[model samples]
Target: MMGFPQLSLVPLVGLQYLTHSSTLLSSPWPLASGLQQMGISQGDVVLLLLPNSIYYPIAFLGVLYLGAIVTSMNPLSSVAEIKKQIADTKACHAFTGPENADKLQALGIPAILVPENALSGSLKDIFSVFYKLIYSRCYLALRPVIKQRDTAAIMYSSGTTGVSKGVMITHRNFIATVAHFVRFEASQYEGSSLDNVYLAVLPLFHIYGLSLFVMGLLSLGSRVVVMKRFDVNEVIKAIDRYKVTHFPVVPPVLTALTKRANDSLAPHSLKSLKQVSCGAALLSMKTIEDFVQTFPHIDLIQGYGMTETTAVGTRGFNTEKLRKPSSIGLLAPNMQAKVVDWNTRSPLPPTSTGELWLHGPGIMKGYLNNAKATLSTIDEEGWLHTGDIVFFDEDGYLHLQDRLKDAIK
Candidate 1:
């Protein structure tokens, strides 16, 4: 799936901008050539600091196509946060909007301004850089050798405990995520994944969103409706307008949607929504109950994962014979887990509370440039000690109990 030319042969529609798969495949060549012209080669890092847009996926894929590492940051991040990440990653260049171009320039890093939307006749002058890059005739003559083990991205973990650290994810890790997590989930459904319409409200910088939107679903030829940010009304309208089938969101978004379902006079506003997946945080039983009651037709599920796991943990699935709203489903395929007593470091039996340890191909290489932290998080036995306390039930459903580490948001 490297470069993804073989997988994405269908059309992709984002925010009314319809781009052919061939254009998506070839658009990266000019960008990679441009980066090479700027003297950025394999192993160099490029920062992407922009909101969700069609360009986000192109830029992310382009960086990987060049064999350079990509490190994405929140577009709304503070100047201090941006500076720290840039310094930490040793980024050579950046792709961002005009609002943050000056900030990167002031730090002596070259920045490429990415437009918020596709350029039309009137907006042509306003988005010259983006317009020129995608249409440029330049082609990369020599492609670098990128091994599966080489780092493809450096996504920063949510600095819940302290300052955020970069998690190095390899190409092989992403392949596993697509296979075991994304495509596997799609396979459990009725139709082909390419027929499913996905709403991309989750930020592209997060591993959950990045894994599904930018890499996984794209590889399966799914249509992704990209939003600049989350807005409840816009989300409803988009789902109705585009017939969005699969929506991946966090608990707050789900809660907001549930509230909308309760207040909206038009019951069919979200008639097209087939499944809603919640992650990043736990959903209260009340929230789950309300959602299930309000939208009985839509499948509501919860998943558990972290940046260290490349977002490849358990995912909720409701079958005709079984439905456990509280559990985070079973472990993903090709993945292993163990619930260990935190104090004793001993594995616990079913229904016993303990910290969750995960082992899989999707596990990240390590925290970039932090060997000590990496050693503590991932043990010598290669199990990633996810600091969340959880347990599995008799039915093999994983349930979240509490967090062993302090985390913010």
Candidate 2:
């Protein structure tokens, strides 16, 4: 609720084409309202399988307004994966584009077609523009106070290494994480006069990119360059063209960044770049040092969290505190963290190797449809048992050791 209320605060007025060509093609509110008009309400679930487009934001927010839950999904989900998630969530309706229409139908679920040509009208075009103006203004005036405990989004845990679980995160958890980002990082940025341009190469589907990079940056009014997919050359060119400052890199991209020479990675006159945040997985110390050496002007930071935690918990390299390479910085204010014995679930003293436990506003409500998994992950005391292995140093710096399950017995 910074500037545009529900919209990004980073000024996009100059980059109108970027948004118009994507999200503004059709009236997002009307389309979102159409779903409510069609009968989905709070607590109801809707499965969405649309391509990476402007409709994603529209659909997501619309679901939020109606108090309904959205399960943003990958179109490439195998029949088995799609069926499983849909059935597990007990989704009553689905809105999909032509690409996945047949797949949704195969599930015998009620589906709505979101066609590419749904917004092709000269009269409707004028009306669409007018609709955006009124809706945006109304969104500002009527910016509702989001309840911290209210479930905002139901995300499927990436089943990459195993079975996918649906994680239910409350609006408060996200806001709290954003509060940490603003207090820790964004406030420093806002003090500067230089324009902030963010290159959002991370998929919104991922927790790292979605809340931290997207919502975090946008809330501060930074202009975001959205790429449907992460192509090396394309991202490089955009940064050069836009003079993008922030690039949220994951471990794989961090590896690539360090592997390539500075000249090979150089974008068009990108002097605006000053920081890079690496998350999703651990960034090697070697990579961090190499990157800092290559781009001395850029501050490299690392963050750690999981989908269950709304990507909160810890991050590394606070300028005000002791910056350590292997450490994931200090816990954000208002959040309590403990190191607990893996087997006994009892709190361990600092410097002792144990599983990380987090209790914060950002802790997700629970895993949707998996009471057993939820109970296992979150104890009766309300602490979230992060499957991550870590140890806190005497100075309160959190150092990454290994994942709980990944650690050798």
Candidate 3:
């Protein structure tokens, strides 16, 4: 984390607020001890079917603390879908809520509920004694030989192109992606991190939100306003209530906001907002211009990446350099890329549209247990053929056009 702007830090905010950074950082250890007590072992896979909440991150880290891999799935996923993933990952335990607990129980999967509304008698009662001890000063130190290349998380692909394959993102991938944001990204996201409060409506299970908001924000020592789900009105209210400054959203939200009356939210509700990062789909120029025009002070940054790259490959990290319009800024540090002509399988020149291939530590270990698919995407030379048809301007901004798979048939 960088030396950030001054503030009495609010490290994490959820159904319960843990205002002190030290307490927030210390909370995970006792929880990790509790997890160990549950017979969770190293190299085992633990499923997290949780929403954005205080328990999510702590549980995520605790599993990793045991040298185990963490895989999170959408809580709203169909029961069959959830069952399929649990079998695929061979997850031994799960952290979920009551809404989805019956599905887990019906499947005979042992799941610990992460409750929100009531604390006294809800199913959370089973874990409340353990949960309360999470922030206890009593720290449990279990230092395993955790390597960066060890699989940190397995997030499923959105499956837009094919069946959802589990993407194996490692620990190093997280460090590399966030470091670029803090130190190098157009010098924009640094210094002011402490002053930033992120609206956590994006699903924490999605790599975009997990890496950028949960993991990245915590590493930066910033405040995160956790939301169980995305509600447009709730988002507006939270922004005003918490003085949220950094916004990470999908294209549809950006598009929806363009049609909202200027007065739908109070004039000054979003006055403290400084940046809005859009991804998960193509961001229309009209949407970007509309947001910029309406806010005047806020900068809209669009980025592109896949779950395999840990949700960051190219981003419009620089506030001033984004004037080029329809591009996803520059390649992250330690990353090499090329645009190769599909027909000849040869590299193409700048402005030549071809399949984008990227090589870096950010590349995942591969699709879990799917060696063939992994080999198909990542070549022997460590290049990940992104399958997205893209071109770079003379100034090196990436412009996405289409997916090579979609282009074929």
Off by over 4 Å in 1: 1-15, 159-162, 406-409
lDDT tens digits, residue span 1-409, model 1: 2322222111123246656667776788798877787788999999999888777788998899899999999999888889999999999989999899878878888888887665678667756766677788987768899999999999998522555799999999989888999888887888777678888888888899999988888878888888877778878878887888889999999999999878873756788889999999899999999999999999988898888888899999889999897889888998999999888899999999898999999899999899888998899989998888888999999999778874213
Task: Estimate, for each residue in 1-409, the C-alpha lDDT of model 2 and write its tens digit.
Answer: 3432112211222231244423432344455455555666567888877554434555655666666777767767787888988888888887676667678778897776553222445544533532343245232223334465777778888422356789897877778767774435666444542256677767666666667544565555556666556666655566676778778888887666655546465453446777788777787777778877877777777777778877787776656455576677768777899998988878899899998888977788988877888888788989887778889999888888887777845
Error of 2 at 202 (Å): 1.3
Ten-residue region with minimum lDDT total, candidate 2: 5-14
Cα RMSD to native, each candidate? 3.5, 5.2, 3.4
Backbone clash count for every predicted candidate, in the order shown = 0, 7, 0
Q: Which stretches of candidate 3 lie over 4 Å from their true place?
A: 1-20, 117-124, 129-142, 158-161, 181-183, 186-190, 318-322
Name the lDDT of candidate 3.
0.74
Ranking by lDDT: 1, 3, 2
TM-score for each of the candidates: 0.93, 0.82, 0.90
Summarize candidate 3's per-residue lDDT along 230-311 as a digit string, tens digits: 6666667677778888888888776665556354756667777888878777776777777777777877777887898887
Q: RMSD, model 1, all Cα superposed?
A: 3.5
Question: TM-score of the candidate numbered 1?
Answer: 0.93
